[model samples]
Target: MIPVKISEEAIKEVRNIMENKNIPDGYGLRVGVRGGGGCSAAGMNYILGFDKPKNTDKTFEVDGIPVYIDKGHVMYVIGMEVRFHNGNDAKGFVFVNPEIEKELN
Candidate 1:
C-alpha cells in the first residue's frame, strides 16, 4: 500500500470543498508528479476531485479519504505528508515531501 498522511484541517477542507462543489461520492485526491514546468525534474500536482484510480497508480486511504499516487512518482513521494495551509498568499493543501529537493535537482 502507498504511504499516506492527512491532516485534520485538510480533511475538513476537502470535505467542505466536495460538499460545496456538489462532487459525487468516491471522489478523492490524486497526488503525483509530472515532468514539466516549475523545476526541470518532476513536480507535484494534484486533482482535487478524482473519481477513478489511474492505471499506473498506487492507492492509499487516510481518514476515509482516498489518495492516489502515480507509480512512476512513488519513489519521490514516500514519507510525504498532506498539510492544510492557510497563509496570506496561498491557502490549500501543501505536500511536505522529504524527497522533493532530491527530485528537483
Candidate 2:
C-alpha cells in the first residue's frame, strides 16, 4: 500500500493530465516535501515526470499509479490524503498531512 491515501478525484485528475500531456509509459507521479528551511511550513510538490528511484527512495503503486518518495520525506507524507481541487480558490492537488497539521497545532 502507498504511504498515503489518494482520493478518487485526485487519481482521475492525474490520469487526465497524463493523457493530455502524453506522458510516457513509465513516467509516474512524483510527490515529496519542499521549502522548510525558510518557510514556517513545508509544502508539498508534485511533478508529472519520469525518474528512477534513488537508493534512498521508497516506491509504491496506488491504483496503477507509481509513486516515488524520498526516504527522508516519508515521515512528513505518511498517512496523508491527496485531493485535487478545481474550485475558485484552488486548482491543484492539496495535501492533507495530519503529521504537519498536528505539529503546527
Candidate 3:
C-alpha cells in the first residue's frame, strides 16, 4: 500500500470546509497526475470537494480524511507528505516529495 501523510491543519481545514459547505458524505480532496499543460511530461493536480473519483484512482486515509490519487501518480507519490502551512507570508497545503525532486534534477 502507498503511504500518504496529511498535516493536522489540513485536516482541520477540510473538516471546516465540509461543515461550512454542508457537503454530504463522499467529498474529499483528490490528487492525481495529468498531462502537464501541453508539456511532454505529466504534472500533479489537486481538487477539493470532489464527489466521485476516477476508476483508476486509489484511495488513502489521512488524519481520518480520505484522499484520492490516480494510479499513474502512485509511484511518484508514495512516501509523500501533505503539510499545511499557515504563516504571515503563506497559508496552504504543500506537497513534499523529495524523490520527485531528485528524479527531476
TM-scores of the candidates are 0.69, 0.74, 0.68
Q: Which stretches of candidate 3 lie over 4 Å from their true place?
A: 37-49, 98-105
Q: How do all the candidates rank in terms of TM-score, highest first?
A: 2, 1, 3
Looking at model 1, residue 58 earns an lDDT score of: 83
lDDT of 2 by residue, 28-75 (tens): 777777745644344445333445567787899878888888887777
Better by lDDT, candidate 3 or 1 = 1
Poorest 10 consecutive residues by lDDT, candidate 1: 39-48
Q: Runs in model 1 with CA error above 4 Å?
A: 36-49, 98-105
RMSD in Å for all candidates: 4.6, 3.8, 3.9
Model 2 residue 72 distance off true place after TM-score fit, in angstroms? 1.2
Candidates' lDDT values, in order? 0.70, 0.75, 0.68
As a TM-score, model 3 comes out at 0.68
Which lDDT tens digits does candidate 1 get at residues 1-105? 556567789888887887788777766777766555664334546334456687887888876777777787676556776778999999978777656647887
lDDT (Cα) of model 2 = 0.75
How far does residue 44 in candidate 1 sit from its true spot (Å)? 5.5
True lDDT of residue 17, candidate 3: 76
